[model samples]
Target: MSARRTSRVLALWCPDWPAVAAAAAADLAPTRPVVVLHANRVVACSQLARSAGVRRGLRRREAQARCPDLYVARDDPDRDARLFEPVATAVDATVPGVEVLRPGLLVLAARGAARFFGSEEQAAEQLVDAVAATGVECRIGIADEMSTAVLAARRAALVAPGTGAQFLASLPVSELAVEPSLAGPERVDLVDLLHRLGLRRIGDFAALTPAEVASRFGVDAIAAHRCARAEPERAPAARPPAPDLTVEYPCDPPIDRIDAAAFAGRLLAVRLHDRLADAAVACTRLAVTAETAAGERLSRIWRCAEPLTPEGTADRVRWQLDGWLTQRALRGHHPDHDEWTGIATIGGQAERPGASRTRRTAPPNGSADNTVAPGRAVPAAPIVLLRLEPVEVVTAGALQLGLWGGEGEQEERFRRALVRVQGLLGGEAVLKGVLSGGRGPAERITLIALGDELSPAADPALPWPGRLPIPAPAVVLVDRPEVILESAAGAPVWITDRGLFTADPAHLRWGTKDWQVAAWSGPWPLDERWWSDGHADAVRAQILLRDDVMVLLLFGRDHIWHAEGLYD
Candidate 1:
């Protein structure tokens, strides 16, 4: 069988949807004048604002002059999709499947729905009615091609299967720029130029031969011309039905730490992908769901342009958890005052001011509750369960591979070797170093698993006042080692209270022996987080030992000397 579905498609579009979505999010009445702006120009205007002479493409000043009381919302892609998701879900209930072209528009197989509903008109009616019940207005159109269907829907009219071309020919060519499926920056420009050339109707554009159009206008224009002519659309080969691929993990001890959640997400992503690989499939869309200890549920579906590998899925899950945790932190009671029971310090001493002790709480379900130490900031809600569901699947073999003799095979072998090492050493034991943004040598690098998500240890983009001038050190000791800095006469070398070095020549001693410094550089001072309690004030000096070894020494705060790095 031909992999392509029938040419007939049904498109559903919500007119002025950005404006509608913004109004809904703000809980404003639909009759209230609203305008959505992008690049300081009106992108979408509500019916109320439209009546006041506000239309798309008008500059912000022009829009305000036309409608003095316009409630203008800045365009946000995430907000648009988040608000539109409910509408798509409502439509999916009536149609067996729906392909979302964008937030405001979608297309589906018309023949199957029409046959099931008894007629194309009835199918469109059912879809329109379903979306309307969600409190958003929609118009549906059925035509033989997706592009034509989009225009037909704007008019709320269905074109007979074979008459899509005739129906589209009468529409203005400007409508081509309005169809999201067919319109892009280039195609929009083409439409404008076509209007200048007096090809004002789809009929005029469709009259040009495909070859001539391709030769002169380029690829996107050729696609638009084909749509104008109602040419057949050849979809990729159909895959088998999605498998019952779902993986769930119970957080026996609810997870409240963002780092803990990220680790768990990575493991779950790996397991989920392994299961799909066993079934000879790959995931295109993934649904992540989490249940909080308070019985609240959070779920989101993430779609990928390419099949989501374990790393990509893990990253998405981690990002979602971060957002949820951040929001909870912002809205919930002060976490710094929470009665956390356990204290787990990673690599450094407790820098923040406070002493906390851990206490174990027994729950009715017999699960151990692991809470942070009291008087420490933490996520307000702990996740009790995490679930991963593969929403869309594709045949694994269908994914294109690199050409033969390419590094693809070598890379696969290298990955397999790393996996074997991980299996031997335990999952978290074997790690790969990843560079992150940071001014300090120790803070700029992090370690993660070979196939796990990569995130920065510290944001390098922030203004760091006391950053050391680089030529970064080749070797950074994982732990800062306490040392003693002394002058030639055995007097302690120190940075004066005025942020100046006490002496010129210096010797360093860590254990029992002392190393004479052959040459040294001035102390570069840094004071960080001065506005907060427990502020750090330190000075670093580079020393070249007589043994031809170079090292960096830090002095300040508690008057302690520590070896920060080495040039080894």
Candidate 2:
């Protein structure tokens, strides 16, 4: 087994940084009460505002009512991230290998700095002094693991060696929910479930074995349990050299959906992977870039533990595109916007749009505010170009021999045959079903090239509410055939506004034939993508016929019914 790459961690935290940054930008006194809001709710508040019961997550009116003089500013994540860069640079000058968790939070390899400063306590004091020079209040904590270090930083305590788990033991179970690193609906629900199960503390949840946690709660919970037990994740390995070849795809009219980009991404990934395979190398770091029609470019670099598979590469491309598109759409910043897509303009340095254009909402601090107004449509920027460049590559290793080597050989043979076919026909012609996790039956399956690896097309760990229960359809039809549900009196059945059935479904009709219903269930309604302007909101229901055929039906806002899928 490989040796563990564990190291002591030091965390630096700046409290209510959004409020602080906003207040500072406004040239307000440090004693003034300020609160930063998002979605009309208070997300960050100054100490003075907090003292007046203007807490985080409170509505704006409630917060203002509590502190009548509280200065309210809209939440701008770009502003927070930009302003925090200097603090990060300052910390890096004092201690190397700093990892920023978010704008207000960061952790560093503490052992070297502690040794340099003669002790961890002295190191923390020096770090605090360094940040204080920037006029921001900072706290420090040192512990054996990142999560424990973050918690300790919150309380401004240094946990002793081999005692991080013990230090975390007394913290409330809800700490897992509030962890900025693990913020998501899934983590929140898991913590809530633990509370309902009488596990009210981190120690209580950590007492269970990893196997038990994995079996019952899934992979995400196991990750949290590891953190609670003070286990440090494996450190990242050193990077390798970049590949010589870079693949690019240009869209003519541009595309809207991420799935459309993913299709092109898969083809490019295979081409890149094949070249690396010929050179007997594997990619470790992939750089994905997408350019909008209006010349704005978006790029991100992803580093993985192992070599990149075709599906893995495609997945990263899809994820990065999703993040960029969602950010632009939600903030009402199209590629054609005069300013940058996500960055805040400083000191009149931002480029201005043409004379014949719309004036954006510019905040007093000389930054553009991209918050979408209520009922305003999110602009759909077309993706015109995609480029996949390998940032790091390593030597491919020999496969480990096992007793099931014959099966491995068979799989290799199949892969070779598919590749040969792909060389003849286009990549899209050689298709295979890849499972994608989602609430809707049609959305759960994705089609990719035949020889590509089967990575998760979507996050299965997500708490997909209203997803169909198990005994999943055996034969999900690829071509969704249109069908109609009829009542006992031969009239079409319709769903009511309250989601109730207008009449009992007694028959199902295809083009010319009608099938009698033996036994049936559902009309379990599902709503999806209501907020996005690109896709219309859809509602769907699943029904089981007496003939034992299971089918999924969809209802649009226009009340038209269509067959979504057929179960095996």
**Best of the candidates, TM-score:** 2
Query: 344-449, model 2: which lDDT tens digit per residue?
Result: 1111122234312222343212311112221122223678888887766766652222243321334566778888989999788788877788876666888887
In model 2, where do residues sit more than 4 Å from their true spots?
1-6, 182-185, 238-511, 514-518, 522-543, 552-568
Error of 1 at 127 (Å): 2.0
lDDT of 1 by residue, 112-176 (tens): 67777788888888777667655678899888777778889889988875787799898899888
RMSD of 2: 17.0
Candidate 2 TM-score, C-alpha based? 0.53
RMSD of 1: 21.0
C-alpha RMSD by candidate, in order: 21.0, 17.0
Question: Given candidate 1, what's the lDDT at residue 220?
Answer: 70
